[model samples]
Structures are given as structure tokens and as C-alpha cells.
Target: MKLLVLFSLFFVLCSVESLKVLVLFHMPVKSLSILGTGVVRHLLNAGHEVTYVTVYPLKNPPTKNFRQIDISKNVELVANDETLTMGYVLEHQIEKNGAYQIQVFSQENARQTFQNENLKKLIQDPNEHFDVVFSDLLESEVYSGLAVLYDCPMIWLYSMGAHWQVLRLIDHGTNPAFTPDYLSPNDLPLSLFERVEELWARIRWQFLKTFITQPEERKIYEETFGPLLAQRGRTLPDYEEVMYNASLIFANEHHAIRDRPATPQNFKYVGGFHIEDPVQPLPKHFQDLIENSKHGVIYFSMGSFLKSNSLPKKLVQELLNMFGQLKQTVIWKFETTLPDVPKNVHIVHWAPQPSILAHPNVKIFITHGGLLSSMEAIHFGVPIIGVPVFFDQFTNINKAVINGYALRVNLNYDLPKGLSAAIDVMLNDDRYSKKVKEMSAIYHDSLTKPGDEIVHWVEHVVRTRGARHLRSPAFNVPLYQRLYLDVLAIILAAVYLVKYIIASFDTKKAKKQSQKKKN
Candidate 1:
């Protein structure tokens, strides 16, 4: 009997010391994304084992001495009109559809590569089990169900800046409305139109999610996962409750960007997750150009994956002509060689961005407003001229403008004239630098460093065994209840009763007067 008890105790201790977590990222390795690496690194810090199911294969994954496996990257994207048309139908049905559109689109691609059944089997096997799960909430439904199958808590990581998706999963996939600032009670600071815009955008997004993106995902889920489950009888869980299983959510955005009213408890902002070696020295030529150029050096980079050389030759020529006129030397991060060279400009295939930003002579940055680029620019107290192309770049540029450190020139806008003026504004104005400095302080002065904040919370969850204590009870309360519908209903009921009483008295008075007149 003593031996049996000792054996049971020994197994429990082993499991606690060796907790496994599975992280799924469905983007390219060079994409220099923020979420995948940050979460994996911190989980390891807390003594939790990690398995990063990479979407794309690498000749070498970034980290050393860590477990990394490339899941098939054959994700089927549902972006074309052919696929989007079906998603339009789903948008018409599901009333809650904020993240559904992108969620469905992105996840469908991943689903095609790795069948859902494989995920379940991985979870259910006794030898291979996870104590907790952390997933980017691009598609909460799929991962949330897996969390339920494992009977564990899930943590959501928002890849992009704060949007409605993170809130949806944290509210247990019930409210469908995402809180802008998880800490504010009122949506102050946003104009009435902006609030309305967010509402309409979410409503439209909800209906399109399942229909357009996951037109066939439901059937796929049942076919692959139904028979393998023990309690679910070979079926999927409720979409509304799928994310209630999440223990906490870690957002890449912070109160610096998303500080607004009516926020949620689940938002833990650990911005700058992709902060690479900030100390790497700049290349010698790049360093010399910035230091030697008599006028301040202006740096132009559109970020990785998008090549500046791919632009029309006409556009390239226009840029080349503009560089010849500038007193400052221009360093364009270009993929291909330029036909005409100007003494004032230099072109390189790749430039260490942070190193250049830190350089004393770099005066202005031209960017696509990717968060990392924008943040680095601000970190150095430099202003930006943004030409946002697509995706969250638009949102990032919009916020930078709102915060007053940057100006956006639309990609489709007349580039030569518009860009020249934007550059002039950054150069002439001292206010932009002052504004960036203010933002830098706010971004850096939070109670905890973003990385440390992330590590602390991750440890908090593990220590508490998924920490339900941190959850907010607001989701269980319905909208009408939140808005005091019962009180309003009572007031409305009383108004009708008073009207009825007044009408009864008037009718009696008219009948008695008529009787007296006849007599």
C-alpha cells in the first residue's frame, strides 16, 4: 500500500516539473513576426517545455537547443473572390463576426496542411500531453476546441496590435464585441463616428467569418476529429464557448497604443516581442554613408518580403531623381541595383534597421509602419514618413499619425510630390521629435518591462494551474444586463400603466356629462 502511494506521488511531481506547451505559428520564418518567438522563449523561462509547430520550414530555426518542428506549410488561403463569396454567406448567419473573416481565412490555410484529427491525437495520447496552450488568436475556434479536448486552459497571443480578436476569445467567444482598452469603462477619446465604425466593422466581420473563410472547415472538423474523441461523441464544441477555455491572453500591443475606455482584464501587452539584438553594429559602408553624409541621412525601407525593386521602373526612376536633389544622402534598402547612381544616395540589399535608427546622423525614416519599424523609430526619438501598403500597416500608420510622430502617404497617392512634402514636415518641425520622445517614455515607463510582464504572467498562470482568478466575470453578464435592461423594462412598464389610468378617467367623465345633458 505504501509503495502504491509513493508511485502515484512520484508521477505527479514529474508532470509538474515537465509541463509541455504547444505553440502554432502560420507565417514565414523571415517574416520577422513578433508572436512565435516571444511566447516560446518565455514559456521555456518558466520551465515549461515548448513545441513550436512552425508553418514554414527553415534550413535552420532561429533558436538553438530548443525543440522545433515544421508542420506542413501547405495552408490553403481563402482570399480570392471565389472563396470570399462563400464567406459572405457565413457573415450573413453568425451574428458575432469580428475576427471571423480573417480568422477563417488564415486558419483554413493551416487546416489544409495539418488535419484537425492529428491535433486531437497529439493531445489525447497519454505519453504526449500539454498542461496549457498558448495560441495566436487569429483563429480562436480551432485551438480553443483543442484546449477543451485536452481539458486544459488556453492563453491567446494577439499577433498584431490590439483589435477585437483578442477580446472575443477572452470573453469566452460569447460577446462578439471586443473592448478597445481592456481597462477603460467608457469608450472615451474615440469620436462617436469611430465607435460606430468599430461596431459596424465587427458586425459585418462576424457574419462573413464562417461562410467566406471556413466554408468547408466545419465538415472537415467533423470528418477528421469526431470519431477520435471520448466525450464529445465525434463532434465539435460550441463556437461561442470555444474560447472561454482560455486562461489569459497576451497582446503584442500595449496601453500606449490601445489605451481607451471599456477595456477587459485579459489584455497583457508585451510589445516588442521581436526585439532582435539591439547592439549589433551597423555594416561599415552603411555606417560610413550616414556618418559622412554632410546633410542628415534619410533611411528608406519597406520591410522584408516586399521588395522595393518590384515597383514599376517609373516609380524607381522617380525615387532616383528625387535623391539627386536632396542635400542629405539617401540609403534605400533595395533588392536590385539601380541603373543611375547619385553620389548622395546608397542602395543595399539588407540594412540592420535598429543599428541605423540608432546612428546619430539618421534624421528621418520612411517605412510601411510595421509595428517593429515604427517602434524602433520612436525608440530613437525619430519621426517617420509612412507609406502603408496593406494589412495592419494601415492601422499602424493611422495610429502613428494620431499620436503625432508620423505622417502617412498613401501608396496609391502621388508619391513624388506627396512624399517630398511629408519629408519636409518631419525635417522642419521640432514638434514631431518632441512627440516621439513623449511616446517613448510612455512605452518604456510601464510598471513592468514588456518582456518581463509577459514572463511574469506566464509564470503566474503556471503557478496557479491556469489562474482562473485573473478572469473577468463580465462575459457571463449579457449586454442588456450590462446596459441595465431590467431597470429600463420596469420604467417602460410603469409608463404604460399610467397612460391607461388617465384614459379610463377621461372616458368616465365624458359619459357622465352626456347622461346629464339628456336628462
Candidate 2:
């Protein structure tokens, strides 16, 4: 019994050995940072030492094991630029200019990140080591070099749903026929025209990637990581190889909320990982306003990237006038104060979005249809009116509309009447609320909480030393072989040979008949 007890204790200690984790999540968006912080928090709770590189640092470090390398100034230089804002996106429709603009911005951001003094120090330190590295799978692939620097496995964290760009790294690209591109405004069961459009969109993106994006990214990759790799006496691998070599990817997606695609074993869905458990109570003023409201409330916010004050003055007045007609109290997340505000319309420079969605008196949510907001609405069982502005917002809102939980409103000067009509439908019809509640139940029915799943998988990769067994075999197969082009070539050659031989025989027979007739 003494020997058995000792063995059990030994196993326990072995299983819980603290791991050194390095995290890089430098995206300027606050929502993406929320997901990254959640990951850092869970790793710290599991007794792991973490070195986090982020734009949004924690106000107070959670523990001594947690260390942050602040890169907010570097990211802000790119993020605060006016050309990348929501107003710019709306002016130049995403189909034409938004994607290219974002790519350019991401390239500049990557350059700035490599130049950050603190990040440079960390990379140059001879004593720095980590058991694993977690990096954001945004447009830039320069950070993957850190995994190579530490000689540890890399895992990618995607801030949105399963996109073809991310999936192509793990497995074959998703078929554009059925799976819409991330920027596409259409969904499944697509019409013939939609499929053609989707295919063209994909081809155009691939063309841009091959001709424009990849070359620039490769240059940055070599310029930033070349010295570090040379110090280690190793030549850099191909940029494609480095980007596609991740051991696993944790996508902010769930089959419950989105359609399930053919994902590989390495692609794990852990959506809503940022939502706090035992959600904190609202502040006194917010609680009082929500609880004391005579009529239910309607919440409006365009998310962090788009400022409500950026709207045209005429449209703003139209919205105010529309809100004045509503009997329900309106809570708008505007960035600045406006004059002549309606008594029922309350304007807050900032609002606690999740807390507001959780309130029982909140009847409807009018949003910009960001994935994070859509997920939150579904999480709290609140139906929404989505006003998608750009990027994946169109796709996310379309999914909600197809799922019967949300209505979409175009962002235009004439949004007031349209928004009011959608609000009426939401308030009068119970179907949207009931459908959203059902989705909420599904979102909550997972076997393990998102936080637990994150920790388990992160440790799993570290314990298994990259977990290569989980990777798809498709990675090893060449495109020609996978498409059976060689087999098709062989069959075509055999058919041509048979036809040639038959033609020769027929000619000989015809000549023999001619000789007999002459004789």
C-alpha cells in the first residue's frame, strides 16, 4: 500500500509539471485580444508560465508566471490610421478595396511589430525558451518564425469562424461551390449565379495571394527572422512550409451556431471562449436603468471599429427621429454626445454589451453584426438586427439570418425606417426569440466548457510533442495525385492506342477487298 501511494503521487506530479508558454496576439482589435487574454488566463490558472505579446495588456498581472511584452504603440500606429476605419470601408465596398487595404495595413503592422524594442529584446535573449508557442492566424504569417526560434510546436488561434484561408493550411481548401468565401454575402444552398460569384471570388483571392501578398510576406519573414535563425545555425524553411506547419488551430467557431464544414482533426472549435463565466453584475446606474424601465429596451451599437458619430448628420437625425417614435427605451453606444436627444433615447460613450444583452428587460439588439457580437447575442438568447458594414460581418449576419434568429439591415442613409420595421417584427413576433433561445441551449450543451477545452488542447499538444498524428493525411498528398490526373492521363493514352490499331486493320481489310475485285 505504501508503494502504491507513492506511485500515485509520482504520477500526479509528473502530469502537472509547469509548462513555459509563449503567446503572440498583436491584432489591434479589442475583441480578438479578449480571446487571447482568455487563453492567457486559463494557462496561468493551470500553473503554466506565459510570455504574452499583445496590444491590449492586462491592467494588473494575474500572477508572477504571467509576463506581458507591450506592443500596443506599434499596433496603434496602423490601427488608428483613418484609411482602415469603418467609414473608409463603407465608402469603398469590400468587394473592391477593403480587402487590399487591410492586407496593406497588416503588412505595415507586421513590420512595426518586428521593430518593437521589447519584442526585439525577447527574441534576442539567449536564455529565452518555451515549451510551446501560440500565435494569431491573422493575415500576417511572420510570427510563426518564433516557434522555429524556440524549436517548439506552434498553434494558431483564429478570432473568427472556419475560413478557407485558415483551413487550407491544415487540409485541402474548402470547395467554393458549397462553402462560401469569408467575405461572401451569400450562404449555403447557393443559386447558380452565387456559386459562380463565389468561385470567382476565391480565384481572385488566390491570384492576389500568389502574386502580391505572398511575396511581400516572404520578404518580411526573411528580413525579420533571418538573423535569429542564422544565430541558431539554421537556414529558414520555405514561407509556405512555416505557415502550414502548425500542430493545431483553435477556431472561434461552434457547430451549434455555424454550419459544420469538413474540418480536420487538428482544427478544434472553441467559440465563445472569451465570455466570462458567472457573468459579473452590471454597474449600479446600468442596473437601475434596466430594472426601472417602464417599457423594454432596445440596444444599439456598431462595435469597436465603427464610430456612431461618424455617420452623416442627416442620417443621425433620422435615427434620432425614429428612436423618438419608439415606446421602448433605446440605449445607443455612441462615441460622442449629441444635442437634442430624445427623452427615451439614452446615449452612452461606452456600454457593457454582454451585460446589456443579459438583461431581462432588453427586448432587441441592433448591431454591426460582428462575429463576437453575434455569438454573444446567441449566448444570452437575445435576437438581433444586424447592420453589417464590411468584411466577415456580412457572412456572420447572413448566417444568423439563415438560422432564423436575426434580421439584416443594410448600412445606408435610409436605415431608420428599415431598422424600425425590423424592430417591430422582433417585438411583435415570438419566433425570433424562441429560435435564438434554442440556439443558446445548443451553444450551452457542449461536453466541456470552452475554457477547459482550450487548456486541455494546449497541454495536449505540449504533452504529445506537436501531436503530428492529428494532422490530415491530405497534407502529404500532392494536388495532381489527389485529383487523379495521372490516372486520367493513363486511361486516355490507352484509348488512343486502341483506336490507332483498329484504324490500321480497317485500312488493310479495305485494300484486300479492292485487290479481290480487281482480280
Candidate 3:
């Protein structure tokens, strides 16, 4: 009895020593905010204490065990953030002028977020200590200084597939022949022209980063975070070193959507962690509408970041008119009500999108092809009519179309006509629905829930003190060495030396032959 009592006490003590984690995610978009919150929720549920630094605060703050350093005011710094219209997106393709825009936006946000007086105060407080730091892997790598300051292992939570830039932090350069850039709209098994373009884009991005982007980012880091780290008696690590120090990268991607190159051991695919089990039931009125729809329902949402109402008023009217004529009950997620509503069309300012997708009556989803929305649609086995807009949406929708579960309609002035045709093809064709269900089964066949898997990895990193063995040594190797250029140079030099020796022997033999002839 005494032995059993001692064992029980030991177990209780072990359980109480949960990790103290620090999370820094300030992106204010609702979907990303939800994803970040989901990570926090899992850590809290696993009995870990978390200090979350974010721009979007929890509506119902945790009563205990969670502390929030809210810099919610930073959201205002991003202009027209709430109104990412289709027109705006199509006009600014990421490959063209969009990459620059993304860089500017990321730096601005990072500047505002990391430079906040309150955040600096938190950093200055020597009393605070943490076991690990988890950060959203954004375009800005400046925030990585947090891991350096805390002297803890860092885990990057990427809300998209492994981009070439993120891969650089973990391993070596990704092959452009097979791995498409995130901003690229091309699907794999790409044509020769597409491959050339992808290769050029990759090269151009690398050049831009090395020459222009990194220098600008370094300045921001020095101006803002450098002084803060110095004050804490922590020497700031070189910007590149801090990036390579990430212990693990949790990418929000899976093979169900698109196949990717072989990843390093430290990368985890936790794509659908945002999905809720036993999805919350829809509101009574919304449930009634879905249930009563005789001709099936078409759910339309441009995701949380892009507002459907932000479309040109004329375009909105045209869409309403087009939906009015359709036999299907159209459920559009508009941020505000239209002055006149069609009898067949339903407009809700905010949507319970996953719940709507899960409905048996929801036959097709018209979406902007955000990764989270794409994952949910696949999870619920719903076919999609993807109207791809800015950023990774084009790439996502292209993959879906290639995967046989979706049809793509570009956002243009003729959107209504294009969307109508795409919708007809998706609904009337049985192949789309059948294919998505098959993919859904594969997605659901994972060994554990994505959230649980993420939790397990987070705990693993904390317990193992950064899990350095899991990280790729390629991160430490120089680019020239990784490509074997030095070896090639050595081989060429040896060949030249052998050629020189042979020529010298031939010259000596010729001179002896001349002397013999003269004698």
C-alpha cells in the first residue's frame, strides 16, 4: 500500500510539470486567427500554460492558465484588409506585382507588431521564462528573434503548404521542376513552358530575397528588435541563424490535396487541425433553410478575409440576379445585407461555413479557394466551384481541379456567366462528387486527429530540448557545397593537370627522336 501510494504521488507530480509555451501570432485574418487559437486550445487542453501574443483576442478569454498580450490595435495599420475584393486580387497577380506587395505588407505588420511598447516590456521582463516558442511562419522572419531571446526551441506553424522560402529555413532548395511556387497557378506534371516559368520565378525570388528583401528585413530587425534583445542581455543571433534554428515546422498541408517533394523529418503535415469534431449545429433558421431546399443548396463564401459584399455594387446585383434564376437555393455569405433580397437567395453576414459544407443538402460549394476552406470542403466530401483570387488561392484551386474534385472559374467582369457554367458542370457531373468522397476517405484515414498529432509533436519538442536531431544538416551547409560545385571544380582541375603532364612527356620524346635523327 505504501509503494502504490508513492507511485501515485510520483505520477501526479509528473503530470503537473506541463510545458510553459509562448505563441506569437498577430495576423488578424479570422481564419488564421482561428487556426492560431486552435493551437492554443490544444496546448491548454494538454495541460500546458501558454502566453499568446496576438492581434485577435479570444472573445471569451480563458479564466486561467492562459495569458494574452493583445496588440489588437495593429490591425488598423493594414489598409483595406477587410475588403479584399475579387477585382483587386485578379489585377494584382502574385508573380507580377503581388510578391512585392506581400513583402511590404508583411514587413509593415511585423514592424507594428514587434515594435509594440507592451510587447517590448514583456521581453524586457527578466522574470519570464518559457520552454518553447511557437510562431506563425509568415513572410517576415524578423520575429524569430523571440526564440533567440527566450533561448528556447522554436516551432513554426505555417498555415499553408511548404513554400520554397520556408523549406530553405529547414533544408536545402526545393526543386522547381516538381514543386510549384505557392503563388503559381500551375498544377504538377507541368508543361515545359510552365516549368521554365516556375524555374525563372524561383531564381528571381532568390535573387530578390538575397539583394533586396533580406537587407530591408535586417534593417527592421536591427531598428526594432536588436535594441530590445541587447537590453535583455541576450546577444541577437544572425538573422539567418535564427531562421535555421526552428526545431520543427507544422505545415497546414497534406497529400490529399497535392503531392509535394520529400520533406525533412522536422516537418509535420497538420492540415485539418482547424476542423472541429462534431461541428457546431447551424442556427435554427439556417438549418431549416438547408433542410427545406428542394433542389439542393449551393453555399458561396469568399472566405473570412475577402468580403463578398466588397464586390462592385453592380457585380453584386448581377450575382444576385444570376442566383435568383437558378433552381438551387443560394446561400451567400455577404458581410452586409443587400437592400433587395431575392426570394430564392439567402444572405447571412457571417457564415458557419464548415457546418454548411457538412450538410447533406449542400451539393456544391462556391469558394475563393482559401486552404482552410479547401480542406473543410474536402473533409465534408463536397465538390467545389473555385473562383480563385489572390495569393495561394490560384494554386489551391488549380490543384483541386487537377485532383478531379473542383472546377475553376477566374474572377472577372464576366464572373456570373463563368461561375454559372462551372456550377452546372460540378452539379450535373457525378464524377466531381464521387471523386471528392474518395479523397475524403483518404484524408480521414490518418492515424490520429490533426490537432492531437500537433499536440504530440509540440510536447516532443519541449521535452527533448528542441529535437535538434530531427533538423536537417542541410541547413548548415552552404549553397555551393550542397550543389557539389566544389567537387566539380576539383574534378576539372585534376583532368587539366593530367593533360599537362601528358603534353610535357610527348614534348620530351619528340626532342629525343630529333636528336637520334640528327646523329
Model 3 CA deviation exceeding 4 Å by range: 1-10, 81-84, 90-97, 510-519
Model 3 agreement with the true structure over 202-250: per-residue lDDT tens digits: 8877777778777888887777667867777767778877767789999
Cα error of candidate 2 at position 447, Å = 0.8
As for lDDT, the candidate ahead, 1 or 3, is: 3
For each candidate, the alpha-carbon lDDT, in order, equals 0.65, 0.86, 0.84
Superposed by TM-score, candidate 2 places the C-alpha of residue 440 at a distance from the truth, in angstroms, of 0.2
| lDDT tens readout by residue for model 2, 204-274 | 77777778877888998898788888987899888888988899999987768657578999999888887
Where is model 1 poorest over a 10-residue stretch in terms of lDDT? 82-91
Model 2: CA > 4 A from native: 1-14, 76-80, 86-98, 506-519
lDDT of 3 at 457: 92
The clash tally of candidate 1 reads: 18
Specify the highest-lDDT model's number.
2
Q: For candidate 1, what is the TM-score?
A: 0.79
- Supply candidate 1's per-residue lDDT for 338: 84
Steric overlap count per candidate: 18, 0, 0
lDDT of 2: 0.86
